[model samples]
Target chain A: MIMIILFVFLCHAVTFCQIEFVKVPMQKKRPIHLALYQIKLPLPGVVSILHRASGLLLFLTLPLLLLMLENSLHSAQTYASLVALFKHPLARLSMLGLLWALLLHLCAGLRYLAIDMHLLNNLKQARESSKAVLMASFLLMLLIGVRLW
Target chain B: MVSRVVVGAHYGLRDWLIQRVTAGVMALGCLSLAIYLALHPGLDYQGWRALFSGDAVRTFALLFMLCLYYHAWIGVRDIAMDYIKPVWLRLLIHVFVILTLIVYAIWSVQILWGY
Candidate 1:
């Protein structure tokens, strides 16, 4: 009888262990489609994304700008050549683009700074500020563009 | 008041502050440059060279370039952290970025002060 009881206990322990070791598959939900044109992001969100994009654009173009500055400062000949290059319509257009990017990035950066300081804490204030930023950037761009062209 | 315990790299505050400070410096530089350019419209080679010939302006320009390098580094590093998931690949990309930024820094110094 004791031997039979021991055998039953062993069987029970083995079955329990087997059950504990069984793997369960996790059920994951499908990801939502993130179509850019189909979805309308908030004004602040759009501004924020543009801020990042402008920053990246500025960073990528830094080397070229630096080279230009260096060449312009190097000597009279190089500086004259660069000035002549800038006289081209295409060069002026590109410069206008860079100018706009710089202005937009600066405005957005100031907005971020204000937000960080808790000056624009509320959603309404944030939205208004973002709109102001956009308007300011465009106005400044236009002013600079006139001179540039 | 209950104190909160935070873990992980905890680089957020420092990076944020640095970015803002560097941005401020760059803004000042840009303002000065803009004013000079506006004042001297149709600037020729001699005029342009004269603008950067000042010791004070050269120093400011150098400082601006250094700040720009740091600012770009932090910005790019944050982007890498957010988007790059694979550990080894992310690390490799980071190393590459650091190297490139270093080279740019050195080149900038040469360009600015080499003459």
Candidate 2:
């Protein structure tokens, strides 16, 4: 990008430079030395990606959740069976996972909506909102985790 | 040869609009639902069944389900497109997603008005 800018700059200033400026030779190379842990992704960016991941998690678990709801409302017997299933450690763990996904998605989604509506315009506001989103998700997760237990 | 007329991001405009519209509705729907559930404390099986037995709640559930499925379809479709490179595999997964959402929609209808 800098090289392209310099080329354009030199083209404008130099008399001998060809002015046919049709194609800009661009470097197709990307960041090959990208170390995931070393790079500090801004809070908003982190939240954005986590939103996508949490959404996928929710999507994958939707069928099972729908089944659970169906069975719970099926009959007294089925509801009782669901309650019994809820007692299993694995069931509880999966439920917790789903809850976290829901919380994260919901919070991040609201943040996005706020941004789209221009509720948070500046970088500082974006950072603050993202922080609030994460904090709210964590607080809700903790509250619900305790309640579920 | 098919002549391509449509150009640029406008091609995705419909999907983008559907995504936003469904997202807004679902967000509001979820908030209202949470409020309703909070008001009804210690809801038992009978309470739940009677609640959905009413037409208003059933319609609300069905409408939200539609919006949710639409929203989810776009989201999942985008994800699969991004991560799943193989064209055949991507198509298979996309078909499975569509079929599953359809089945879930039917199941939701059954649950809401099953009695």
Best by DockQ: 2
The DockQ-based CAPRI class assigned to model 1 is acceptable
Residue pairs clashing in model 2 are none
Fnat scores for every prediction: 0.50, 0.58
lDDT per model vs. reference:
0.83, 0.82
Give the per-residue lDDT digits (tens) of candidate 2, residues B1-114. 977532212356798878888878877887887676778878888987887778887898888888989888888888877787777788788889899999889988987778
> Per-residue lDDT of A10-120 in model 2, one digit per residue for the tens?
877764433323223323343376788998989999998899999888888888888887888889999989989999999998888788888889889878777778899
Give the number of the best model, judged by TM-score: 2
**Number of the top-ranking candidate, with lDDT as the measure:** 1
Give the C-alpha miss distance for residue B5 in model 1, angstroms: 20
- Alpha carbon deviation, residue A47, candidate 2 (Å): 1.1
Candidate 1 per-residue lDDT, tens place, A1-149, comes to: 99999999999999987765553322234457799899888899989888878888888897789889888878877877887998899998888888888899999999999988889988899899999999999899999898767
Q: For candidate 2, give the lDDT of residue B79.
A: 82
Q: Give candidate 1 regions above 4 Å deviation.
A: A1-38, B1-10
